[model samples]
Target: MKLRIAILGTRGIPNHYGGFEHISEYVSTGLVRRGHEVSVYNSHNHPYKDDNWNGVSIIHCYDPEYFLGPAGQFVYDLNCIRDARKRNFDVIIVMGYTSSSVWGSMYPKNSAIITNMDGLEWKRSKYSKPVQNFLKYAERLAVKYSQYYVSDSMVIKQYLARKYAVNSRYIPYGADTITPAEREQITPHEARKEDYFLLMARMEPENNIETILEGYNQSNSEKPFQVLGSTDNRFGKYIAHKFKNDSRIEFKGSIYDTAKVRALQNNSYLYFHGHSVGGTNPSLLEAMASEALIAAHNNPFNQAVLSKDAYYFSSPAEVKELVETVQRRDTEKLMVSNNVQKIKNLFSWESVVDGYEQYAMECYLDFNNGKIIS
Candidate 1:
């Protein structure tokens, strides 16, 4: 059934940010293609100032977060919710609840609420004890208010089930395998092809950026290691200071250009994924889709997705050992091939979109029948 859907959270479409924005772009457009009316909320300062994106309508709401700092996020969410309440939407999907859950009651009662419970945010090392406690409280409120929940990983689904005694639907993020033509568009390598390893993630503590850099430093490998993403934050500055003397480590600040990023991933001798807190990471999936030999952090979330196809590391020592041991580029050729096939069959955009569409339909039916799925 074609239902009126409104997607809240994230800084809006064309995905200049993280996973939620990425999913919002794909799912909103996909729903529109399926004949459903979809409206995505965009922050006033978003780069894409258009009234519409693809077939989805964009509602620009005032976001004071730029001037307000951390507290500004709550104001932005409140503004979005206030605007959303004015319009009647059949289903409202909120991506993350670090700020939005506080305004849960402001959502329209006529609509069904579905919250995508992202990885345990309270567990991140970046937040202080007080902020972590607030995050935990926010998570509880998000679960209590929403009619249904969506988990991006099986691990998160299980957490919701055990902690809140609520069943959540598991729906992972999607990725596309890079085409040879796309590689050609990015052009010949500025960095030597397959000579350097790659690590692309936000320079956050929970992302294990420092650990990865330390591990790379400990290893005697002569290959250059390219570190992508911004290094201007407090922790980033610390990492930069600590690894400043290591000439092998090259910090290439956030590469948002899709073609260039894909080329880096596709040609890297090895791709390092050190994210410890999140569910199925978009970067890891993107690296796999690029057929890059991966070495991810050892965790249930990463393990569930990569299984036995990817090498896993925990400490700086382990990462160092891995770097020293896995010398050849094509050593994990079989695993890389397996990862490529996994993306086509399981993590494709079509499958991910279908999963969301099916869940939305089910929630809509339940809401219409005066039944709450939660």
Candidate 2:
């Protein structure tokens, strides 16, 4: 329909690094291909300005300290809303509800604003009291101000329904397409390191990383476990050193390269996801896409994703038991292969972008109908 759209929190898209980035890239590019005029508001640190990345316009905003992390998100996103105010976009999609969504919420009924609420920041135990309180307030503001909210997991939607009384539709993170030949060559069965277990995640306390290490250390199995992700934090490094004597565990540090991470995923004997917070994590989705025999923390969000296909653990004993049980289950491998096909078919880039594309069309029509966009 040649609709004009602008995206905030533009660090995502162009497949930069994280899950949201991959999603943004897919959806934004899909819109561009669908004949919509799209522009992503990016930071100055990004290498390009006003360039066509996958048919989408790239608008670079010059925010000096925006890259500093959580706090700076508000500053840059405020700039996005300010600049977008002068444009003719029919819809403005923002991410990280507290970051760009909050910026759009502050604006009047100028644009149809849709916010993607990826995680529950209020549940994290690491933030200070003041910050946590501020996050809770921001969550309210985001819901109150935006026209609609998109949640990636059912758990998150339920949390919002209970906590903020908002309804969030479940649109999970999409999975990449791995060709049969590629999958065959990359399988753990082909690799000599196939016997090793795998854990991939960003280093954080609430992720229950400490317990995962302790469980691995207690394991009587001779097979080594591969740990991927940065452990720059004091506690993360301390845990690493404590388990240093156990040659069964090896920390590979932060792997920014998706291809390398995928290879590891495709090569692992099994996958371990210990995230205790957030909903519909990208790393977990990617792990499933790689067809890893899985053992995840027993949480509603993880359960929703696995859907009775993978193993779940609540404690160290449970994790060890599930891992061993998965070792003997040939039927579980068949289910993973089947689920891999399902994930590819249902969560592909085409399907995901089509969903977002429909949402944009609806928002555009609502704006044209003189509806009050929150």
Q: Best by TM-score, which number?
A: 1
The clash count of every prediction, one per candidate, is 0, 1
- Compute the lDDT for candidate 1: 0.90
Model 2 agreement with the true structure over 59-172: per-residue lDDT tens digits:
877665645665676787787778888887888877766565556445646678777887888788778798788888777778877877788888888887898877665677
lDDT of 1 by residue, 271-344 (tens): 99998897888888999998889999998989999999989898999989888888554548889999999999
lDDT of 1 at 108: 82
Model 2: pairs clashing at backbone N, Cα or C within 3 Å: 13-25
In candidate 1, position 139 carries an lDDT of 98
Candidate closest to the true structure, highest lDDT: 1
Q: List the candidates' TM-scores in order.
A: 0.96, 0.91
Which residue window of length 10 is worst by lDDT in model 2? Answer: 181-190
The regions of model 2 sitting more than 4 angstroms off are 66-70, 101-105, 180-190, 370-374
